[model samples]
Target: MDLTPRTAPEAAAPSTRRRWVPLLVLGLVVAAGGVLVARFLTSAVDYYCNVDEIGERAGCEKGRSLRVQGTVEDGTIERTDGTTSFVISFN
Candidate 1:
């Protein structure tokens, strides 16, 4: 007679992925949030410049954000397509 204890086959245990899924999702969210905040801060930093000076400066090329201060010429304001267009005079 066999004296060894007998055991039946058991179902496979759950995977480790179930435990790590929440942590993985949280990490991704934090990383994405950090990227958004960094972009907002960098893009928000702007320099002041006049329209006349922008043409002469090489660093004032396209894709650069600047605050252009000038006086709009009188009688040059026009409204079209829900947009206001005007000529600014920089002296």
Candidate 2:
């Protein structure tokens, strides 16, 4: 081949595409992870409310798991072989 004088020996800056590609990929991964974590945390969170306020409160919607606070009434506790069920009252 032809001989040319080398002014700069591999001392050039890296191209913009090579540098920004990884950074862009990392940013997208982080955003996706954040969205997944947020959805998981929100789904794991349960609604807490009083027994009497089940239908009146926004967090006490039916068919949803809830942490209801109430006083246990006597004679309502039933202990079966594998389960113990009871009734509670707020008033």
Candidate 3:
């Protein structure tokens, strides 16, 4: 008489992670594209200055592009040689 045990071969489990890697990579690519577009759009906007901020003269200089906001005084408009100039008060 003999005492012995028999064993059967088992197959490996299938992997489900392969499907998620491509999706994750696609999401990352879309997010990076959005950030780059936003940065470029913001850079195109021009800078502006207030009436009281003219004396600072840090970023303000001649021939530089900028916007200024002020209220024109009554009857201060002058037109000469197809040009116009006006005086503004901060009051």
Number of the top TM-score candidate = 2
RMSD after Cα superposition, model 2: 5.4
lDDT of 3 by residue, 5-75 (tens): 76767876656787788989999999999999999888776657666667576655556567777788889
User: What residue runs in model 2 are displaced by over 4 Å at the alpha carbon?
Assistant: 1-10, 79-84
* Residue pairs with clashing backbones, model 2: none
**24-86: candidate 1 lDDT, tens digit per residue:** 999999999999999999888886778887867765656788778899999999999999999
Which portions of model 1 miss their true places by more than 4 Å? 1-37
lDDT-based ranking? 2, 1, 3
* Candidates ranked, most accurate by TM-score first: 2, 1, 3
Inter-residue clash pairs, candidate 1: none
Q: For model 2, how does the per-residue alpha-carbon lDDT over 8-88 read when each residue is reduced to its tens digit? A: 677779899999999999999999999999999999998889998898888798988898899999999999998999999
Give me the overall lDDT of model 3: 0.77
* Candidates' C-alpha lDDT: 0.86, 0.91, 0.77
Stretches of candidate 3 above 4 Å error? 1-45
